[model samples]
Target: MAPALKRSYQFVVDNFLKLLLIPTALAISNKYEEIMHLCNSMHFTSLHLLCASFLIIYALTLLLVSRPRPVYLVDYALFKPPRSYRVSFAGFMEHARMGRLFSEPKSVHFMMKILERSGLGEETCLPPALHYIPPTLTMAMAREEAELVIFSAMDSLFSKTGIKPKQIDILVLNCSLFSPTPSLTASVINKYKIRSNIKSFNLSGMGCSAGLISVDLARDLLQRHHNSYAVVISTEILTPNSYLGKERAMLLPNCLFRMGAAAVLLSNRSSDRRRAKYRLSHVVRTHKGADDKSYGCVSQEEDDEGNVGIKLNIDLMAVAGEALKSNITAIGPLVLPASEQLLFALSLIGRKLFNPKWKAYVPDFKEAFEHFCIHAGGRAVIDELQKNLRLTNEQVEASRMTLHRFGNTSSSSLWYELSYIESKGRMKKGDRVWQIAFGSGFKCNSAVWKCNRTIKPPAEGAWADCIDKYPVHIPEVVKL
Candidate 1:
C-alpha cells in the first residue's frame, strides 16, 4: 500500500479501537444502572436486555456510516497544439487580416511590435489552412475549425483509451458561443455512429466554468447509473465571433481568445481501474448573476461603439478572490491536513478577536496540489490570479503559456493547460491537480483531480510540440 494509504489505514485502526472501547464502557455503566433499577422495580430481564442490544447496534451503525470511502480517478485525456503549429501575435494578426489589412504600414508595424514581444514571435507558424478566411466565409470557417479541433482531440483521446465510441453510454459536449442546428454532440454521435439509445447532453452559454460543471454532472450520472462510461468534449468557436474595428473592450477578446478543445472519458466500472489518473476529488461552483456589479467584471457586451465584445474588468480579481475563499472554506474541512485545519481555525479565531475585517491567510496550497490549471483568460487575468493565490511562476506558467500560444479556448482552456503540463513531462503518479475557471454569469468553478498513475504522454496531440518556447512576452495589442 502507498504511504498515504498506510497512514490512513493506521489512523482508522487506532480510532476504531478507541471507538470500540467507548461503547463497551458505556454499556457496562448502563448495565449497572439497569441491574439496580430491575431489582428495585422488579422489571423483566427481557426488556432490559433488548434496550442494551439496540443501543450497541445503533452506535455501530453510526461508526460505519461515518468512515470514509476511497474514490479513485479511472482515466483522463487532454488535447493541445500539434508540434508544427506556431503563430506569433504578429503572425496571427497578419494572417487574421488575410494580407488585406497587413498591406497597410500601420497594420504591419502594429503586428510586428506585438509579435516581437509575444513568445510565439520567434516560433514556427502553423499550416496556412489554420489562418483566417475571408469575412464572408467566417461562419463557415468557424464551424470547420470547431469540427477539426474537436474531432482530432476526441480521436486521439479515444485512441489512447482503446475504447470504441459506440461503447460510450453517455456524451456531454460544452461550447459556450456556438450551437448549430445539429449540436456538436449530435455531430459526434452521427460521425461515430454511437448507439441510437445513448444518453447525451449539450451545454451552451455556460461560459468557461462549464467544463467543471459538466464534470460535476457526469459524476452524478456515473454514481447513479453504475458501470458506465461518459465522454465529455469541450471547445469554443473563434472565427465569426472574432471582433474587428477599434473598440478597446471588443478588442480584448480578439487579443486573448484562441482555438482549442479537449476530450475526457470517465468510467465508474471497477474493472478498468489501473488506467485512470486523477480520480475526481471535489467540485465547487459559485455564481453571481449579471445583475451583480461583479458581473460586469468579466462579462461580454456591446460597447457604445456598437461593437460586441467581452470586458475584462478590474473588479473581477477581487470578486474571484472572495469566491475562492468561500470555496476553500467549504472544501478545506474535507481534504485539509489535520495540522493545517487546526492552524486555520486558530487563525480564524485570532482574526475575529483582533481584526474583525482581517482576511485570514489561506494555507499554502503548494502542499496540497502538485499542479494548478487556472483558466487562460488573458495575461492580466493570469498575472492577477497568480499573485492572489500566491502561486509560483512555474505553477502559473502553463496557464500563461497556453493563453500566449493558443489564446483563450473558453471553457476548454483548462484542458490545454493540462496538456502543457503533460507535454513538459511534469506529471507523475499520485500527483494532485487543481483546475479553476471564471466565466460569464460571474461564475467561478473549481475541480480537484488526483492522478491514479503515470501514463505515456500524448505526442502530436494538442499543444505538446509548441510549448517548449511558449509564453512569449508580447507588448503590442493586436486585434484577432
Candidate 2:
C-alpha cells in the first residue's frame, strides 16, 4: 500500500476499536444501574444494551469509510486563436517611423523596402492611417494599437468557438502591462453584450505565466459549478508604453513585443466532451522569488548606456532550468509512470551518492508528454528549455516559430504555439500536451492537457494559412 493509504488505514482501525469499547462500557454501567433499581436482570439488560451499541458503532464506521474522495475532472475544451494577426516587422517598423527612432526618412523607406523584398510587406494588415505617420510621430500613433490587436484576436477566438457571449458563466482576462480604466474584461463584456450575471475578473502585472494561472482559476470555477463555461482571454497591449528613447531597457520591449491575443473556453459539462480537444489534467505553480540571482536574470532595467532594455543574460537558461526542476519535482510523482519514476529515483540516488556535485538527472519528458509548448519568451529561453528537457527539435519548433512570427505576446504566446500545432494538423486523439511558462513574479506555472479527439485546424485561424513555411532554423547568435 502507499504510505498515505497505510496511514489512513491504521488510523481507522485504531479509532474503530476505541469507539466499540466506549458503548460496551456504557452498557455495563447501565446494567449496574438497573440492578440497583431492580428494574430488570443485570445480564439480560446488559446484553440488550450491548447489542444496540454494536449496531450503532458499526453504522458509524461504515459512514466514515464510504465518504467520497476528491477527483479533478475536465469535461470540455474550446481553443481560440486570435482573429487578426500581424507580423512583428510590420508593427515594429511602423512604431519606429512614427516615434522618429530613425533620423532620416530614408531609413524608414529602406526598412520598408527590405520588408517588401522579404515577402512580408504584402502580408501586413495594419490600418492605412498607421502608415502615413512620420518617423518622429510613431509614439502618438501607437496609442490604440494594442487595443486594436487584442480586439481582433478576441473576436476571432470567440467566433470560432461558437460560444455566444450570453452563454458564458465566467470571464477572465489577463494583460500584464495594460489594465485600462474600463478594463479589458469590461470591453469584452460590452462588445459581446454578455449577460449581466456573468462573473468577471481582470488580472494585471502577473507576467507571461499568468495565462496558465488564469486557466487554473477557470478550472476551479468549472469544477465547482459542473455545467458552466468560462471564457479566458490573454493578450498584451502596445500603445502608450512604446518607448521612443534610446534607453536599452526600454529598447528590448520594442524588439521583443508584438501584437497577439488568445481566448479559451473551458467547461465541466460531460456532454461537451465530444467536441473538446483536450481535458485539463493537472496544474502546477511554483514561485522562486527569494532567489535574487534568478529574479534579475531576465528583468527590465536601464543599461550603462542609459537605454531602457530587457537584459537577456547568458545565465537565464540556467535559471529557467532550476525553475523547471522545481516544477517537475512537484509534478512528476503525480503523472510519471511507475517504471519511469523508478528509473528517475534510482538515477537521483546515484547522482547524490556518487557525486554530490553532479547535475541532477533530467527525466525524458517525451515519456510524459506527446507535445510540448514552452513559452516563447525568447530564442535563448526556448533553446535552453529544449536542452534541459531533452526535447527534440520538432517538439521545440512550435514555440520557436511562434516567437519568430509573433514575437513575445506575453501571456498569449502559448496559444500561438498551440495554433501552430493545430495548423500543421499534428494534434491527435489521446496525445498529451504540456505548457510551461515563466514570468515576472519569477513564477513558473504549467498545465497538462490530454487530447480527447482529433481536431480539424481552423480555416481562418491565426496560423492556419501561414504554417507551411515555418520552423525556420534561426541560428543562435554567438557573442564574441
Candidate 3:
C-alpha cells in the first residue's frame, strides 16, 4: 500500500471506537420512530413511570460520578529579588576572573562569546554565594539559596491568595539539580507548619520542563480528592549546580541559567472558581527517551577532571525538534478546531498520495490560544519556535522579553513569561493561553489554560519594576 493509504488505515485503527460511534448513532436514528412507538405503547402505568425515572436517575448519577473534576488556578507568585542581587555583564566577567575557574585564555574567550550571544540582559541576578572570589559551592550555601528563593515565592503566593499553610492538602515542588536530604517539600512543610497528613512530593533531575510536570501531578491529585488545594513550586538552585568546568558545552549554562522561583496554587473546590485566575484545559507531554540520541542529548555528566556540569550535546536542537514534532501532533487534535484538523489531515494525506513537494499544513495555533508562553530557554530556541509556529512578534513578546530580563531560569521560566504577559495587562477573561516547555529528559510538555477572570498588572512581581522598559531590542549578537 502507498504511505497515504497506510497512514489513513492507521488513523482508522487508532480511532476505531470513535469511528464506531458514528455508525452506531446512525443505526439508532434509523430505528428512532419504532423506538418512540414502543415507548408510547409501554409507558401507561404509574409503576412503569417510576421504573423509567429510576433508570434515568441511575444513568445520570453514573455519568456525573465518572467525569473528572475541574481544576482551577487560584493564584501564582514570582520571586522578586532585591536590586542589589542584579549582575551586569562586566560584573559577571569580573567575578569569573576572580574565581580563576578557567585556566586557559581560550576558555575565558569562549565564555565571553557565549555570554554576548546569550539572550540575558544586564539585570539578571545570581545567588549571593556566587559573588565571592573562588565562589562557594558548599551544601550549606545551597540550602540557604534554596530557602530564600522558595520561601519568598511561597510567602507571596500565600499572601496573594489569602490562604494559610494549613489549608494546603497537597504540596509538589521541583528543583532539577538540587534535592538535598529532608527534601525540599519537607522544608516547605516545616516553614509553613502545614498539616502532618498532607500529601507531599519532591521531584528532582527532571530538568527545565519540570514545572508543568508538577502542575500535571497536582491536577491528578486534585481530581482524586474533592475540595482540596495543592501548591506547586518550581525553581533552580544555582549554588550546587553551577559548572566550574572549562568545557565549552558545560560552560554555556553558567552564562544562561540564573536565580529565580515561582509558586502556584491549584484548587478543585467548586466555590473557588469565582476567584480563580485560570481553568486548566489540557496537559500533554511527549518523551523521546526511547531513542538513545534523544535520551542523551542534554545530561549532567562528569568531565575529565571529575567536574560535574550539564552538557549540551551538538545534536540537542535536532532532538528537541523531534520531541516538539511528536508533542504538537498529540496536542493538535485536543486544542485545534475541527476545520483546522481536517485541513491538516487532508494536506498530509495529499502530500503522501500526490506530490511530495507539497508543503505540509501547520495548523494555526493562534486560533486556539490568545497568548503563548514559550519557555525562555535561549535565543535560538525561541527563534526556531517562532518561525515554525508562524507566530508574530507581538504573540511571542512575553517569551522574548522574559529571556532578556530574567535569563534562562529553567523550570520556573514559563511562569516568568506568563507574569510578563499579565504585567502588560494583555490577559482578559475567556482568553486562552498555551505554555510550552522542553527539558533534559528530551521531553516536550504543553499546558492549555483559559482565563477565569480579567487580570490586571501586578503591583509586585518579577516584571513590576521594569516591564515598561521591555519589549527591548536584542540583537542577534553583541560585538563586545
Candidate 4:
C-alpha cells in the first residue's frame, strides 16, 4: 500500500473503538427526548437504572483492559566459559606480540599499559578465535562464539525456569558487532525449535547498554501480549570485534572485552510471580546521538590504516557523564523518595535563580536502592561512577568485581554484576536494584528492579567458582 493509504488505514485501526463510540453517542443524542419521556413512565425507570449500571460496568471493563500488564523477571542465566580459555595479562600480551598485528614497540607497550590497568583479572576467558596467534576473525568463528555464549546461557535459563521453548511468545537478541545472515534470533529459534509465530527482534550496534534496551522492549511486548513470556539474550561476539589494529583508540576494546552472555526470561503471567526473582519497575533510556561528540565518542570505523575497530574517543568519559545526568534526571522522580525529589527540585530552583556556580546537589541514591549494578565497562568507567554517585565500596563492589572476573562483556556486564550481588547473598525481598549502563550511542540507560523474594547464593554460576575471591584489592596501577 502507499504510505498515505497505510497511514490512513492505521489511523482508522487506532481509532476503531472511538469510531464505534461516536455512532453510539449519536444514537443516544437522537433518542434523548424519547429517553427522557421513557424515564417519566413507571416501568421504564427500572430499565433506565439497568442501562446506567451497564454503562458503569462497561467503563470499569475498559479501565481493566487498558491497564498495562506487570512484567516479571522470572529467571536469568549467565554464561561461564571453560577454564582453558582464561587469559592472563602476560598471556594476552604474548598473543598480541605473536599476532604481528602490532609490529611497533610503542603499540605493544600501549596495549600493555591498558591491560595492566583494565581492572580485568587473569582468569577472564576469551573465545578460542582470539586465543589464536593471528586471531581468526572468520564469520564461522564469530558464529561459534555467539552460539557458545548465547546457547549456554539459554540452556541454563530454560533448565532453571522449566519454561519450554514453545511457551515463549517473544525473543529479543542483541549483539553489538555481530549481526549475521540468519540473525542470532533466527539461529536461536532454529536451535530450540521455538514456535514459528514467536515475535522476535534482533538488535545490533547498540553498545553496552543494549541489554537493558532489550529488557525495555520485552516489557513493552509483554504489556501488549497478556500472559505471555519473553526471552532476552544479550552478548557481545568478541571474536569479530577484537581489534587487530595499531591505533591506541581502537585497541582499547581488545584489552578490555572478554567472553560473556546472559539469557533473561520475562513474563506477564500471574502464575509466574511466585517463582520470579524480580519485577521490572522502571526503564529510562537517554540517547545523546544528536550531538556529534556524543555520537562519535565510541564508534566502529576503519582507521587511517584501513583496519576496522571500535574507537574510544578521549571525550568518552565526559560524554557518558552528560548522558548519565540526563537519564538520572528523568528517572529520579520515578524512583527517588519524595523527600529526595523535593530537595532536588529545590536545589535546581536555587541554582537557576540564586547561584549558578553552586555545586549541584546529588541526591543520595543509597537511600533509594539496596543494590546497584553499574555496567562493568572498565576500571575508569567504574571508578568515575563510584566517585560521581558517591557510592560506597560495597555499592560498587559487584561492578568492580564483575569487571575483574569477566572483563568488559559489553551489555551483558550488568547482568554479571547483578549475578554477583545474588551470589554474595546481598539480594533480599523488597530490595531495589538500580542497573545503569552507558553505550556507544552515547546513551545511558537504567533499569530498576524490585526483588520478589529473598535470594540465596547460586549453586553454580559464573560467580560460583570465584565469588569468595572477589572484593580483591585492585591497585591503582599494576607493574608487570
| Candidate 2 runs further than 4 Å off | 1-143, 297-315, 473-480
Candidate 3 lDDT, 231-325, residue by residue in tens: 99999999988888888889899999998999999999999999999999999999888999999999999999899999999998888888988
**lDDT (Cα atoms) of all candidates against the true structure:** 0.71, 0.69, 0.91, 0.90
Top-scoring candidate (lDDT): 3
Q: Which portions of model 4 miss their true places by more than 4 Å? A: 1-60
Q: Write the per-residue lDDT of candidate 2 for residues 224-257, one digit (tens) a residue.
A: 6646888888876655444444543335555566
lDDT of 4 by residue, 1-480 (tens): 476984575567546777889989999999999998886775657788899899999999999989888899998999999999999888988877777886678889998998878888889999999888788989999999899999999999989999899999999999989999999999999999999899999999999999999999999888888889999999999888777778999989888889999999999999999899999999999999999999999999998878999999999999999998999899998887665676688899999999999788887788689999999999888889998889999999999999888898999999999999999998999999999999987899999999999999999988998889878998877877
Provide the lDDT at 45 for model 4: 73
In the predicted model 3, the residue pairs found to clash are none
* Candidate 1 structure quality by residue, lDDT tens digits, 76-164: 55545554555665556656556453345554455454444333323432322446443433556666767787888888877788889
Ranking by TM-score: 3, 4, 1, 2
Evaluated at residue 312, the lDDT of candidate 1 is 60
lDDT pick, better of 1 and 2: 1
The alpha-carbon RMSD values of the candidates against the true structure, listed in the order shown, are: 6.7, 10.4, 5.4, 11.4
Q: Please provide TM-scores, in order, for all candidate models, with all chains considered together.
A: 0.77, 0.73, 0.91, 0.88
Q: Candidate 4 clash total?
A: 0
